[model samples]
Target: MLTGALSSRMSSSVSSSDRIFPPSSFGSFESPGIRASSCFSGPNADMNEYDETDLFSISWNQDYGCFAAGTSHGFHIYNCEPFKEIFRRELKNGGFKFVEMLFRCNILALVGAAANSSYPPNKVLIWDDHQSRSIAEFTFRSEVHGVKLRRDGIVIVLKHKIYVYNFMDLKLLHQIETLANPRGLCCLSHHSNTFVLACPGLHKGQVRVEHFGLNVTKLINAHDSQIACFMLTMDGLLLATASVKGTLIRIFNTMDGSRLQEVRRGVNRAEINSIALSPNVQWLAASSDKGTVHIFSLKVRVSGLDSITHPNSPQGPALFHQNSSTSIDPLVSPNTGANPNSLLSFMRGILRKYFSSEWSFAQLHLPGNTQFIVAFGSLNSVMIVGMDGSFYKCSFDPVHGGEMVQQEYVRFLR
Candidate 1:
């Protein structure tokens, strides 16, 4: 049972599973329940005007129907339907490069975009939208790149490490070191008791996955190049991973490092921007530097898919690999293969170089080789945001695959 050292105090009798989360940093700790309501909160009175010069990041809250765009003037919240700007707030001493909202509510985590700013670059301010003020904050020793808030805990991502804190008062719970991750790549499972964390391993092409509550950690040699992107199902039972090569994507069982399914986007190597899983686990979506988004069906039961994914197939869920233990050993081989330098490995690598990967069941190519972030909405709809500041609401059918149809589009900037 490998475990991360808790920077905070550890109880003498706390079990391994429960020891990861410690008591509150404050005197009292209460689990904060989610209250979903939509509002664009800001202190500014001008909704029609914004300083576009400092604009760098835009994030759409799929569940809230509102998105936040960061700028030198602080951040603005916009309603997607009418495409109206609802809230505006400006930072007095510095600017934000990343602003993360908690659902549709006013609660937000603000991170400084620069090395020298009004606030420390490594600090996070958890704000309350209704009150139009910050209620709490968590400071780190290094610049903070990403922040994820869950009902039970908050996960903060620095360039080289991840910090898990109890959600209510922001007490330090656990800390895990990762490789060079400047983009802050990590995810959390809100639908289950499980907390999933993915970070670079000791070697390239390897990823470490920790199932927090289950006390299970697995090292998956998931790709050839450095891992580019990854996502977990709502229930945390499956994982989808992509490498920097942007060629092959894989679906794995989280309980054990079992490679379940693999999909290819193209043969030519490209930079994959993001990969997402649908709400139902029936669809997998990906977007890359090629300015295209592809959604593939994950329904293993379909006739032509594969025997294991077939409806009546006798194979049970993939067996947890023999190397399912907690260590992140680079040389530990998984149960899927025996020889790392076998003839089959050589041929597979050759085939990959020539044939590329398989095409998605459905795909959409944008106007240019635009970089974008992908998020799912209700009823088979996906929201795409391009680096050039173009946004599109596209819809597709999962049962009978077809080209994604654009429902609505807005260009925030030209």
Candidate 2:
């Protein structure tokens, strides 16, 4: 076990939960185009350059075309088009614990940590930054891990349960049961009444889903191994799940709860930190403890890109949604793992606690390491940010040969 002092000494300057994604893809580098910036390279905004000593958190608002950042100093918002700062609020208080924005609006949910007096650790304040104070606050007895906001309501996740509250009045609407989850793996449909929540299930290798609008609970017997990570699309139309094995990644249809396709992440067991879908739900990106980031094409079925490719190369979209009927045919069942009764399978189960290697289709090896968050900047471009405050923007041309070019980079902390 890592001692507290040693763990603190080895910890990264930033953690995955503190990073943010660009609201949309920036492939063209034209509209919300970000050219190489000398902002942090030279005279910076307010001379507030990022250093390892600061605790920072960030998020991007596509609707507002801006990004919000929280630091030990204070919280601020910046525009993407011109790559300039719009405003920064100075607060030496724990700055902000978990900060979330609503479509570039003045509405933000602020969770305070040790330093902030405006709110407590268990309280979530519906912040009206226009007024620079909280208009509504919800208090709980337990420490809040994270807070998620949707148009209809807000979801607050605890270690064992989840609560959904109405946005207009902050009234409790639904309470859900989950496993011991510290990260709050909940994703709400951006435009619909649906939301997906995963918690520990009836047994090992199982996951529990609480669907709000549909009024149903789904138990996906997805893997023989324990579930590692899962994510829902913005529209809640699909779900991507990975197991502890880290050898297979499966996509599901939320409407009927059917496995649509399965793709191999690798044959080895690795710790996966994050999985995210593109704005169009056509691309799926993931990152793990291996110090390698992977982007998988979801435009086609997982049986193989053979059907949708240009018929010359084995690269293109994995048309999961388009040819749904054919994609689910029994003959093309993707071999995710070995037979349940195989001797090798039994051996793997016993040896899983040790380390193993996993492979990704479109992988970019990072120069340094920590858990990272993966997001699509544009259809052809991806952004990878390490918990240690390392940032990278890489663009790849998958059709010809998936070669990633580091387009831009910046270190948030020295």
Candidate 3:
């Protein structure tokens, strides 16, 4: 009834394309759809982005939320969150050539070979974070194999003999004769003022545990080959020992000195160079001559010990007992086995589970084919030192199903 111009203007203007695909229809198509590939992808897609270089050693400073690294040139300090370098210092003392750094209670201890000398005199330098200069320096006759800071800040040097000193005063406290040349020393924090020494002798390795002046336990012929490294948990509940022949890593009960589990890696013989224990006492890590690091979880099993005290229980403390009159094997003698409530049975269960699983190794390229030292610090960080003037800092993520699957895939490919 209306005129053509008036009716056309009154109707809504619309294009042919709009009529074919209306706004309502386009809205339905705009809804996002899930892709199968995106749904199934793993979380490690970005892991390969970071270049893994020849890391010399890595240590974490819990107080500062940072970690320190010692390399061939000098030391690098990095923030832990994003792993960014905050500071780097070039060593005027010929770099960290064949050296190792130990961080204890905000004190940085540097142990390494001196410059220009083929047989570098083992040197220990301690630096406090608050102060710019080194606070203490101790020289050793032999190359320092290992260094440990005790609870009271006493620095223990494991050379041919064990030397204890008040780090603050640089005063010598005790010197104990060792059964073998000590390769490793660890302070047992939980066991009433005790420490354990790992000595790898020409014949066999030995583990000696002492509390103050009293020797609590000693294991002779502990390892078939030379004992290369050892570690004790913070609580002194578990002890891990590795031999020169890296095939076997034995975990023991610190209380009664009984084997809990024996973890082995590789079918052929490999030399275990260093070892470290996790902060939670949940994991034990070992590095071998083959340039591989192996980690294992602790699965403890506890059963009551047999409630019978052996005849040897009455033999006035096993450490001081005179064996001249007794024709008994000290290890098998009743006196040595008299801890009815020692909880050795429960420890053995934990070891059994640890050894049952086949371990997977993570290969690392070190600076040289040098013997490397390893230590577990705050957080999930590990520091390693190669003989050839290189230090590496390695960080680990907790194992998950995806990681296990990936590890298996890599193993199968090899």
* Top model number, TM-score: 1
lDDT of 1 by residue, 218-287 (tens): 8888887888888866546677899889988888766668776667788788888988776655678899
Q: lDDT for each of the candidates?
A: 0.64, 0.58, 0.46
Model 1 residue runs over 4 Å out of place are: 1-50, 60-65, 79-84, 300-357, 399-402
- The root-mean-square deviation over C-alpha atoms between each candidate and the true structure, in angstroms, is 10.7, 12.9, 25.3
Q: 1-414, model 3: which lDDT tens digit per residue?
A: 110100000111122320111111111243122111101011222222223323344444422245555543345555533334555444322333222233324356555434512122355545443434344555554565555554444444454566666444445666655645644344434222444433333355676654343455455456766676676654454568876667777777655777765556666778777677665545567777787666665443332122123543433323211111121112312222323333555675666533443354333444336566555545555555454434456656655311211110000000
Least accurate 10 contiguous residues by lDDT in model 3: 1-10
lDDT of 2 by residue, 1-414 (tens): 110100001101111231211111222322132122111011124433343345456555533255566665546665544344666554433456677777767787766665655445666656665544345555666777777777677778777777877676445678777767766566655654445555556466666666666677777777788678887765455678887777677777655567765666666678887787776555677878887777776532343445444357656433344333232211223223422223444466567522222224466777765777666775477776665655677877756425477887766544
Give the higher-lDDT candidate: 1 or 2: 1
TM-scores for all predictions: 0.74, 0.69, 0.56
Note the clash tally of each candidate: 2, 12, 14
lDDT of 2: 0.58
Model 3 residue 347 CA deviation in Å:
22
